[model samples]
Target: MKYDWILFDADETLFHFDAFRGMQVMFKRFGIDFTEKQYADYQLVNKPLWVDYQDGKISAEQLKVTRFQGWADKLNVTPKALNSAFLEAMADICTLLPGASELIEALTGQAKLGIITNGFTELQQIRLDRTGMSDYFEYVVISEEVGVAKPDGGIFAHAHQLMGNPCKSTVLMVGDNPHSDVLGGMNFGIDTCWLNTQAAQRPEGIAPSYEVSSLQQLQRILLA
Candidate 1:
């Protein structure tokens, strides 16, 4: 392997983060049918909140509570309660992305693995345990705990510290988000791989060390 430490982004990079499905499942428990229109409306609020969270403009708690506030009011529940329920629903439905298991297994002895995610702590651990992926990672750095999200070098620096300060060139950060995972790693002076599964155009002025359409392809590149 070319890298001694491999850091992965949790949502969509390794796990299937179907927020709409998770919300639907969560709302069902409260006797509410979450419709596509509602989901679309939710995204309008949720998406910007995530960007703010990533940019360090909002706290994780704020993002979580604010996004669910409308729904919480309608359901006559606290936003915190709704957020917890949503995370629970997400954990219940969490699954590894295609080829995630194979890739992680392949790199087990060759390199150390870690996860640096902007996702909430409430869901990450349980989801990893349920998917049998908890043992593979040596570190799981959550933005919620770190108080800094990806695209900021601070979170990556924290991850590097947890990794025992591996050589920058010998650590590779992989994720689906070009902005957060790719730019963050690059700015931190480490190698990065963008898992562009959707074949999205690269954002201007941000480039990754590598790009692949699938984890299988990334595995092949790493093991080549």
Candidate 2:
């Protein structure tokens, strides 16, 4: 086989955190009552902060603590209380995406596998262990632990090194995000396969070498 490595992205790419449950449980811990609309509001407020954190503008501790703090601050709640509750809730939730296990099983022994995710090391590891996806990966690099996030060439370079530096052409980077996963792989000279689960249009200029709507599509591509 010409290719020796297959790098994956966590979160929606590998496992989808039932973040709604996480949020609801977290809120309940704080003694705050909220409807689904409020949970959606919390995500809207926190998501951009996470993106900024991934881009190096913030720290993991800040991400964990401040997202809830800021939200509570806006809602006139005690930020400290919310933070503690949020942590507890985040710790409690567990939801893996559809086909996650089957996809990992399908790839086993076919190529060297690893994870390159732009998330906190502790939380991301928890997700993997919780979802039983940890053993499948020989290398798992979280951006916060690595001190560099994806879409930054350094993280990809670091993941490549972790994978023992396979040929760029042969290595395939599969991710759900166009900017981070697709462009990041392009920067590393690795072929990218975008997983567009939502049926979003591929961005205007950037292109992935392969595009698949579901994890099952990967099986056909690999087999063929």
Candidate 3:
């Protein structure tokens, strides 16, 4: 392996995060149909919160509770309760991305693997365990626990500390988001690979060491 430590983002990098489907599953308990339009509306509330969370403008607790406040009001439940239930619903529907298993299998034992995700603490381990990917990662860092999100050097610093302060040049950070994953790693003085699965246009001033369309491709390049 080229890297001594390989770090990954959880959602969308290794796992498929279907928030709309998860919302439908969550609202089913309340007898809500949770239409597509409702999901679109929910994204209006959720997306900005994620930006704010990554920007250090909001706490993860605030983002979680605020996003569910409207639903909690309608259902006569606490926002925290709704958030927990939503996480459970998400866990119930979680699955690894295509070739995520193979990529991890190929990388494991060759390099120390770790996860650095902006996702909630409640859902991370459950998804790993459910997908049988728990043992492959030596560290699973959560933004909620770290009090900082990616694109911020603090979270990367925390991860490096957990990794026993490995040589930054020999560490590779891989994720789908160019901003959070690529930019963060670059700013933290580590190499990064952008998992451009959606084929989205790369944003200005954000460059990655490598780019690939899928985990299968990433595995091939890393193990080449």
Candidate 4:
């Protein structure tokens, strides 16, 4: 095999996390109105909590409770309601990204595939299973489970280890984020492919080995 393994990032790459839908449902059940502004605010707070949790500064459970608690405190809402609401929202809303299943199937058996992501392990698993993507990957490494997030290099190293330490030149890391996925892969000497759906330019001083606007573009690279 030219490429021994193919790694993917889950969030925006595999599926569109319907975060607003879940949040809305949770808020409605609690008789609370969730505004767009509030949703954005909470995400800002939650993102860092997750990063901290991934980096070993806090536990996964702590990250979840703290994000809800922090948002409830900021909005003067009951934390009890926030907890149940968050879970309810998470369960009700999960949308697979366009062509996600097709993409997975296309790469299946052509090269070993896996997911390297930073998110709740259970939630991500639910996504893969629900979307019928679990069968495509031999490995799925979540930062929360792996004790490190991307951009830190450790998580990338752990993921590589899980792939039996394939030669860096024979691995392809694909994801949406430049700072995390692309940078992490580059740091480990693996070729990185940036999935820039929005036409964003590569960050200065950090260039990916390949860049494509959509997952479909990968077809050409693999076939070549």
Count clashes in each candidate, considering only residues at least 3 apart in sequence or on different chains: 0, 0, 0, 0
* Candidate 1 vs 4: which has more TM-score: 1
**Best-first order by lDDT:** 1, 3, 4, 2
Global CA lDDT of candidate 3, please? 0.94
Candidate 3 displacement at residue 70 in angstroms? 0.9
Candidate 1 lDDT, 119-203, residue by residue in tens: 9999999989999999999999999999999999999999999888877989999999999999999999999999999999999
Q: How far out, in Å, is residue 167 in model 2?
A: 1.5
Where does candidate 1 stray beyond 4 Å? none
lDDT tens digits, residues 1-224, model 2? 44578888987888775677777777665576668897777788788977887677887667777667767776677765666555446656756667778878978888888889886665766677777877889899888788878888999999888877776887988999998899989988999989999999779877898899998897678756
Query: Model 3 shows how many backbone clashes?
Result: 0
Model 1 is weakest, by summed lDDT over 10 consecutive residues, at 160-169
lDDT of 2 at 129: 77
Q: Compose the digit string of candidate 4's lDDT tens values, residues 1-224.
A: 46878899988888776777788888777677889998898888888876676456876667767778876786687665676566546756777767677777877888999899876675777777777777888998887777778867888888888788877899999999897889888888889989899998778977898898887887677757
Model 2 stretches astray by more than 4 angstroms: 71-91
Error in Å for residue 201 of model 4: 3.0
lDDT of 2 at 87: 44
Ranking by TM-score: 1, 3, 2, 4
Residue-wise C-alpha lDDT for candidate 3, range 1-224, written one tens digit per residue: 78999999999999999988998999998898999999898889999999999999999989989998998998999999999999999999999999999999998788999999999999999999999988889999999999999999999999999889988999999999999999999999999999999899999999999999999999999999
* lDDT of model number 2: 0.79
Q: In candidate 4, how many Å is residue 179 off? A: 1.1
Per-model lDDT: 0.95, 0.79, 0.94, 0.79
Residue pairs in candidate 1 whose N, alpha carbon or C atoms collide under 3 angstroms: none
